[model samples]
Target: MPDLEPHRRELHVHCYRMLASYEEAEDAVQETFLKAWRGWDKFDGDNLFRAWLYRIATNVCLDMIRRTSRQVVTMNSFAEVPWLQPFPDRMLPSDEEPDAVVVNRETIELAFIATMQLLPARQRAAFIARDVLDWSAKETASLLDISVAAANSALQRARATMQEKLPERRSEWTSAELSDEERDLLARFIDAHERCDAAAAIAAAAQDIRVTMPPAPMCFNGLDQLAPLLERAFGPDRDGDWKLVPTVANRMPCSASYLRRPGDTVFRVFKMDVLRVADGKIAEITTFGPSATLKAFDLPQTL
Candidate 1:
């Protein structure tokens, strides 16, 4: 039998894009590998091994999606899909990998992942395969076991939906790396958290900034709604002293926060905030708990 380990990372990323959860993607990759090993005799020597693995991985994701009741009824905010999670940059394929799927800023960002949840399972797979992965219509159809015409139709619908739901300026965002403006804004954000300065944080955010904490039904829009939360976070009787470390997730600027409650000597991992910046200010902040994600970022549990 041939080695299957080489394809693991890219397969995991493909599953992540389809399912929008890190843990679920990991499971899907494992299931794919198991199925591939069991059915290796079915594989033709003439066909590409990587594509075969992807076919298995994609189907695994589709099965997982069907079994779960994680459908999104409306395409509004990231909070609406509580299952949404950030993909750590450390696990992404390095720029040097030849066959690695290009993890561009537009495709892997939080907004794109959350919006993709609005698509049906098959359409999401089609979009990722045909458009994101640059697969041919015939190739995608073969992967999904559908006719070429049907695959094209699915890609069309998926593209239309993505364009409608994604931000208008998405087309204009060309840089794959973080810009200086974004780094500056992130610095201000981290400094504000460490200093407990709400004003500085607010200044770094857009006037209509939005905040959402997933797995919790909390969504706050605009600075007016955001102020009270910041006030409480930095208040005299707040949880404790805060420490923030800058990191990158989903090709966007992020901060991993640590908190030391009253009498707690060491700061402990709290949550991660993935920022979506617009016009030099933070336009959206999607926050996730640190327990399931910190290790992916290679962050310490306590400081």
Candidate 2:
């Protein structure tokens, strides 16, 4: 048997991009491998093995999407995607794999993932294969088990939707790593959160910053809305004191927060806030529960 383990990480990234849920993507990759193993004899020796695996993975994601009740009409905000989850930066393929699809910061960012949920399953698959993976039209068609024309059409529609829905700034789609300014801002964010200084934290954020806690369907837009929430969170009556650990997710800066509640001696895992920085200020924050795989972030469950 071929060494399937070598392809696991990249395949996991692919499935992650397709499903936008870390747990579901992990499941899809496992299902893909199982299906590939069972159907190994059917795979042609002349064909690309990686592509074959991807086809299986894409189909698995499509089926998973079909089974879900979630629907995206117009994704005005990440709040609309209650199922959206963050991908750990450490789990991504290393830079040594120059050809890895996860190298593209734009494709793996939380905003991109949320916007992609707006696409239909096959269109999502087609877009990822053709655009992010740089597969040829015919190859994408073969992977999706569709005709070349249909694949091309799906790709076009997907492109149009992405173009219409994605952020308007050109720099937002670049492959660059987080800049020094972003790192500085992240440090300030962590400091403010840890100190429970609502004023300091709000000062670091943009005036029109947006905060959303996914799987909750709530959005706090602008400083006016976010201010009171921060005050309440940092208030004496708050459930706990916060301790934030600096981390990266989806190629963006993040803070893995732990809470030492009243009467509790140890701080336990709480939630993660992934920041989207713009113009040297924190523009958006997507908060996900600690349900994420913390080992990937090298984070201890308690402190």
Candidate 3:
């Protein structure tokens, strides 16, 4: 029996991109494996195993997708997708070369994932199959059970939609790994929070920064608007102290913040901030979860 474990992570990531929700993607992968197991006798064993598994996974996602609305997501803000979740960079398939790293980074960025919501499910599948996965038109057509011309057409539309929806800063999406500049900025952000210096934290952000805590209707845009919020967050005599551990998510910098109350012995996981850094500034911050279960990220239990 062929072990499906090796393809599990990438399949989860693929499904995450397809479904735009971490939890659902996880289930999709498990289901994918279960289906693969039941159908193992039919597998030719001569064809590419990864491709065969992806075909099944993609079909599963598309079937699930057909049950949902294909509304062209003209989201006024990212807050609309409460289901949107972070993808940890550490979990990405390891690649040593800089160029290869960047290629992986582009497809998994928050912007890319969010914008992809706009396309019809079939078109999204076709586009991702051909462009992101580097599948040939014939391969994509076969995967989606469509003609090659239709697959190419879908791919073109997806590319156009992505180009229109993505921010201008898309060009700066390259960083084989965190550069010195990104680390310094992350350090300042961590220091500001840990030291309870609201001003310093606010200063590290871009003027047109955006903060979104998903599943919350609130999103603060611009420093002038968001400054007061950070002020209270780092306010003096705040109930407890914050400790930040650097982590990476969605191929960008992030921090997992733990809170220790005045008399508490252990620091508990409180929330996470997934950062979108560009031009040496924190352009976007998406924070959610007092996530205690972080074995997925290999994070410490308490500090």
Candidate 4:
């Protein structure tokens, strides 16, 4: 179990990348542990425990994916189909005491995960394991039960695809340690949302802020566009009572928005929006995990 402790955080992250749902990631970790315990006798001391455990987790994720082809509701999906669920922050790990690993918003940002959804499953695993996690090609191959050459090829393909889709930096700019100003900005953002003040919310965002809603393709950019977006969100059509429940994903602070309904005793969990802030301005927004994942963060569906 001592060996397991070191890898638990990473296992959660890896599984989240594979399954793209925090609750599923937790379940995958538990499932991996059970499998590991049962197969402990067969374990070889020669292998790296982190890498070995990752293999089990990856396989578990793959099996789950095979069973359910998780769909991304994009702008396209929203236009063509019905109801696209927002990934809630309540489903992510708590932001207050995140894992020690470097916490960059992009690491678990819903936008990044949505981009990952575009790749083939094996390519997704290979890219995340080798490039994101810094595993070697040989190690990645061993984990995926593929040849080293195949892993290399998959990694290259994954890199190419990711580069095309996401041009953001590969390294993180922030860690568990956040700047005082950043923290203050997050507090203000939370306050603005709670107050349902569109002007205050817009003021907190950067001029070039961008928002993306996934399993749907609709993306809105710039303050000009975002102002109206917020206006509609907090405008006359609905009650303005909302709450922002703090959570974490990929090491950045996030909020699960809850809407109060008429005659309802508590605020009902609505959507999870993960933010990437740079220089006190919002850079990106990702809505990934469905409401079902909220339980992972100890968030109630209705609060």
Candidate 5:
């Protein structure tokens, strides 16, 4: 009702940070928009439109967290069926101003999101609103419907918990600050995957890189380990003729890799592999998702 398009996209991003699942974020944003429309007549344009949207989105996410528990996929926590889903890279709306103008991988990585899941709902909101979004304590307090002092307390607790859970690579976490060379490195990584060249792919990765596949509990660390892993995945014996569709997730450059099967004479979409780079080399890789959301990334299901 009030110039919704600009605020809508940002609100979607905000909801995503609150609720790591992309589908849930979409639902929350829809609910926020509907509520905004219904309450439009009573609105006073005193505060920023984005701020008002954040308030709605925050409340929506809070309701969701109150109802559902955080998703965990560790070895001790494996279940009869996988419970979490990866966000499709293609569905994330592009920015006219480039990645610099939007959120970064440091704040939105799957690792960070999983770490956030450990915090209480209000503490999670307070930390993200204050630290990640750069909102002031007073502003975050107003949005969360709590006192500024309480917000500050929640944020501090959240930060302390996250510091222990996440890796200590704060310098490389800022995705907005990636250099031209770093971007080019990602481009080359994509090119290598599309060409199905394992050597080139290995060359692009760090010597001791860590590749983690969520919801699967498979992890390969170090170049020696990763080389064999890549060979098994992309080699001629298994899932040959690989094609990587360019996309993004967690505010980081990503690709949904598809495999061309000779027996079926068609390409089958498979994994969503999201990358994290540091110092112009692939540092971490997290892969997941099924065919349902894979199509949303504009990837070829059967090429």
Candidate 6:
């Protein structure tokens, strides 16, 4: 039982990959632990505890996917999966995780997770086992209860899907934890939003920046398209005073934004804006509502 404690974070991450929703993944991990405890007598101790626990976690996620619609997989963009959530870097498995379960940066990146959500469940499982976890074909097959050939076939299909869905800048992906340049840009972005300064906001962004808010079909792809949107957000016609607190999500620099209406005394959380900086400019922004996991961040309810 004590041995299982060390592997909890890794198991949670594996389940997270299987289920795109962060909260759902947590639920699945809890269930996995429960199942493991109830079936302890069935284990002969021949197989490693980590491997056994992962099998339980994977099956739990698979069952959940079987019950729910995989419609998010068929969607063209991540915004279509309104329930998609970020995993805080602080919650990830420690670097001390053994080589077999080491959680690599590229595999845990938000972009990587977003694209993984678009793959079929079995393919996603096969891909993670083979590529991300470095499991052998026989091991993956044994865990999935499939023939080795079938596991290889599924992995090949998953790889093709990944290449198609993932962005082209593989070289730049997860290049650093938080580079100095990105930090400067993030500071400017926070200042711009707090001041509601459209010019400053636009200045911090790339010429063709991309922005998307989940649960909304709104995706502004370029500066020309975003100009009016920025005006509406920051212009005098806006209804509130804004404040932003620096934060991090999905290993990217972000800000938790709050708004105070004309008569209100305290600032209330509005949303979280996660930024992607490239070459000294803001390349993309993904904004998420705070209602789902605001408490996870331990932020104050009022100013």
C-alpha TM-score for every candidate: 0.97, 0.96, 0.91, 0.75, 0.79, 0.93
Tens digits of per-residue lDDT, candidate 2, 1-303, equal: 586777777888898878888888988888988999999999998998888888899999989999994559888789898888898888888867734555678888887888888999999999999888999999999999999999999999999999999887845557647788889999999999889999899889999999999888889999999988887889887888999998889989999999999999999999999999998899999888886667767899999
Number of the top-ranking candidate, with TM-score as the measure: 1
* lDDT digits (tens) for residues 84-199 of candidate 6: 77776667776666633655557776677888877778888999999988889999998899999999999999999889877777666544377788789989998998888999
Q: Per-residue lDDT for 273-299 in model 1, tens only? A: 999889989999999999877788999
Candidate RMSDs in order: 1.1, 1.5, 2.7, 4.7, 4.1, 1.9
Q: Is candidate 1 or candidate 4 better by TM-score?
A: 1
Q: Candidate 5, which ten residues in sequence have the lowest lDDT sum?
A: 72-81
Rank by TM-score (best first): 1, 2, 6, 3, 5, 4
Model 3 lDDT-worst window of ten: 95-104
Q: What tens digits encode model 3's per-residue C-alpha lDDT throughout 201-261?
A: 8789999999888767678899988877776677765768989999888887889999998
lDDT tens digits by residue: candidate 4, 155-219: 99988877877646645543544456666777877898887788888888888887776556566
Error of 5 at 231 (Å): 4.2
Clashing residue pairs found in predicted model 3: none
Let me know the TM-score candidate 2 reaches against the reference structure.
0.96
For model 1, what is the error of residue 28's alpha carbon versus the real structure, in angstroms, after optimal superposition? 0.7
Model 2 per-residue lDDT at 51: 86
RMSD of model 5 against the true structure: 4.1
Worst 10 residues of 2 by lDDT: 95-104
Better of 1 and 6 by lDDT: 1
Summed backbone clashes in each candidate are 0, 0, 0, 12, 0, 0
How does candidate 6 score on lDDT? 0.81
